[model samples]
Target: MSLRSYLVNLKQALSSRTFKTPYRIVTGNQSADMDSVVSAITFAYLTYSLKTPNEYIIPLIDIPREDFALRRDINKLLSYHNITEDLLYFVEDFDKFLDKSTSIDLSLVDHNGLQGVEINKGFDGGQVNVEAIIDHHADEGHFENANPRIIRTCGSNSTLVFHYFHDLAAGQEEFWESNKDVIELSLGPLLIDTSNMTQKVEDPDIKAFEFYKKVLASDTVNFTAQSNYNDFYKTLKTAKKDISGFSFADILRKDYKQFKFLHDDRVGFSSISKPLSWIANKFSIQDIKDDLSRTLKANQIELLVITASFTQKDTGIYTREFCYYYEGQNEKYAELYQLVWQQLELSTDLYRSEAISSLTNGVNDSGSHLKIYNQKKVTATRKQVVPIVKEVLEK
Candidate 1:
């Protein structure tokens, strides 16, 4: 089945007043990065094409419709591939059906845990069944009972789904030849996540690339692997970093993820592509703090962590910044701030200037926020920072 036909069928199902039983939702992380989006869509398409044992297979974008605009790169890529918004559904659309007592099955891609839907109101883990999970991140053991949980340290979840489809379609030459567009769409995320197979590319990723090459070669379409890789990677990377007209709140929520830790303590992390200095130039510090505070109250989280990365336009030098904030007089927030600050300060990869105070003055003394650091070395990513914060909170 081609993507267009599958989308038409999905639209018909959604338009109907009543849905069929045993409905399946394929989703990715809340961030909805390229890897997550492509993985969910491609995997869901493969499942539907293969006639998986499900009455309905819906691929959800895992974010609200408004948030989709924040992903500039993904929007460009989708447009380039002629994937329209009408063919896709977001979390806002899915939330309306949660009240109905339907047997909804979830297949999580790009993230293993239940964080995607766990935060939804009236969410009961026991009620909605988790069918499968394909991810490459650190597992938090949220879906221990989920079957067919394929988790590894591969570069992208798309690679895993590609191989799964390959194996399922094995010994079927016609099936492979017909899904050339699917193969092409799947390659976008693989290349972006692996940095054109230059970063974090493992054996599985290599094998998946080889499989795609061989399949595309056999097809009548002319697909050049090297040229496609270069074009896709550069375009996607530029789109990912293009945050030109985004508001402060949208910037924070662009790549944000929420976490619940240690008995009623809620935490949120926002990964901003631009540096703190750039944000400061655009918005006042108070405005930034107000936005952060609003996010905390709206989500009922105890603390909020903002990490920003910036690359100099001319020199290509990279730097990072970390900032944490909470309501005034929150002891738990204060303690967590100190713990995270000390851990980051001690890291060999990050350089802290001795001349600058460990804690920023105005923010800390304001009694609501703790500190912001330059992180001169700029080595640690959210993947590394999350674990350190988790360890401190667990202790």
Candidate 2:
């Protein structure tokens, strides 16, 4: 059955009979991608529509060190609809916020927060709402206490949430057409999360096309498909490793004549100077981490480098960074990346993990690991061409 039908059936089954206070629905973290947002919104719509007007309080948890761009995007959309911040609960520290809750009685709070009661006291943050988890990350222990939990490791959590909304809206003949807007609202982040198909998941190409058609049908201007267009272009440009113009193997052969492999743990860590400009541009670091988990099987690689580097941007300079992990005994990955980072002497971002699921995962159909890290430097001539470009352009 379509996802919409399932939601209708689920809602019907849950609230077949009830006269109670409104449902206080809580979504974890504002830094959450579109999938999470869409999921929360779908739940709000379903519970509110099915019950009375006062039946739901949808509060969005805010994460600190927020992504300013994403925040602006969400604020703009909320403003377009005249929605205020009061509707959003900006809790920077979930622990402190939950601790401030006057009501301590589990029997008093709603069903979702009951499981939340124990989770809140002992929760160390990653994804929020241990009591109300709705993610599909493998091994995510979210909402174990909550029933009918929805967690599918699809390309994006938004996709799952979109399905939920589509299911709910389709049931109401008057709302079927508007459901398309929810799908469109979700498409922007899904595109962001997938990096325009560079980092893909199962059936990704099919999902993108289907969502594209639905987004085009969404007449809601704010929810247009191009919401994050500029960021997408920037990310794509940065993601390209620029290896097309040069032979890395040849360069490495000549330059590495004096180089040495330092440490050879199943993993080694290092940082770089200019940062791999492209790594952050087109791919979420999480995708890299996930791929590593699949390839290494042990989640712990033989070698890993969380490289950070400095870049010359308009704001004087800034640090860009990402993690690189490898298997077997190539310890050079750590030393080389670290040397690159130090040579540049810029700021660095640090990455660390010890998940074994990544190290022992088998190879894909291509005979490579499910994930591959391409570290070829662009042609040596490109470095020479830089001075020429500077001379010509500046002159």
Candidate 3:
């Protein structure tokens, strides 16, 4: 269903005796995650305009970068209108403040319950009472019993929000003007999130053309300053900066004493140096991809493995996109591309762990160099290692 219809149904349900009490809205903790925040704000706008006493609370779960593109969005909205820090709350710990009084609802604009499940799991399996969910992730038919689950696998979550606000604005110039701030705020996160996700549609080439068209048509002035890009990048950098501190070769010599081929079939494995692993946790997939590309070109290595570490919080998400050159034919890479679908079958934890293990554990074959991408496992000795979770490439 469209966000519009979902909002209508949600309004009806809210009017019902079921959700008449005051409630708080919980959203993703990460910055540049304007989708949830915008949705929550829109709902708050509705309550405020209607003179409802319902208090709207939007909580953030993570630390956004210094130049988070999305914050500029909220700043734009706040600039045009009157919004204060009071309207939005950031929290590193959810358990400290969450209860029925803290009505935690989600505005995930998609078709899947992956995020919903992930977020809810953080709350220890307690039913979050997610009254409604508005998202565009591929519809996996998950999220049971949500009041109004509007999951459409469209271009972006902002697209869904745009249609909702557009319909609600309905030719009101003043309202439209004010709403533009929300749209601007919503757009930054949407664009960045989609970009990071590597989201592609069936007709991806065509869709990309259309998507860029829409982006170009959008008011560039509404976007955050290019300077704002640094904050997100800084946060990303902070997440995975230490991986380069030590050479994997040196660590093997010191710790393992002797490197033995577990299999050496086609892929070779190298234990990430403790210092390097400590550092690698600060880099993301993109950083790894860029570095790998350079190293591969320099050493003329057809395939290489890079092991980085992230915190328990960001265990499953992939931070980089890699390009592999198959030996046989160009079509071989195409066939390898299809492995992503099979890869997606693995649960988030399994996927992240196995991928990291494959890289850090041991190599079986050297001829086929699988280019395993693994995250270093952090334990008591690695506690000093900071948590550097880069934004996963959403695609």
- What RMSD does each model have against the real structure? 3.3, 17.3, 15.4
278 Cα displacement, candidate 1 (Å): 1.4
lDDT (tens digit, per residue) of candidate 3 on 1-395: 22233334545554455653344453532322345455555544543343233443343423222223224444444443345443344433333334433535443433234232235454456535555556654444556676456666554555554555445546654543434444444544454445433453323323433433344344444344333444543443333232334433322211110111223212111223232333235455345434544444433333332333333344553333222322223333334334442332212333345444433333223322233322223321111111111101111
Q: Return the top candidate by TM-score.
A: 1
Candidate 1 residues lying further than 4 Å off, grouped into runs, are 51-54, 116-122, 217-226, 313-315, 341-367, 376-379
Give per-residue CA lDDT, model 1, range 1-395, as digits (tens): 56766777788877786776556788888788888888888888888777564356788887778789899888877775578888888887665545454457888898886664433442464556777898899887777777668888898889988877777778776776787777777778888878788988999999888877777664334346544668767887888888888778889889988777766667888999775556656776667667877888876788888887777676787777777778778666676656876656533232233212332343455556745666543567777787888788877
TM-score of 3: 0.42
- lDDT comparison, 1 vs 2, better candidate: 1
TM-score of 2: 0.44
Q: Stretches of candidate 3 above 4 Å error?
A: 1-22, 29-59, 62-87, 91-93, 99-127, 144-147, 169-173, 190-395
Clashes of 1: 0
Each prediction's TM-score versus the true structure: 0.88, 0.44, 0.42
Full ranking by TM-score: 1, 2, 3
Per-prediction count of colliding residue pairs? Answer: 0, 35, 44
Top of the candidates by lDDT: 1
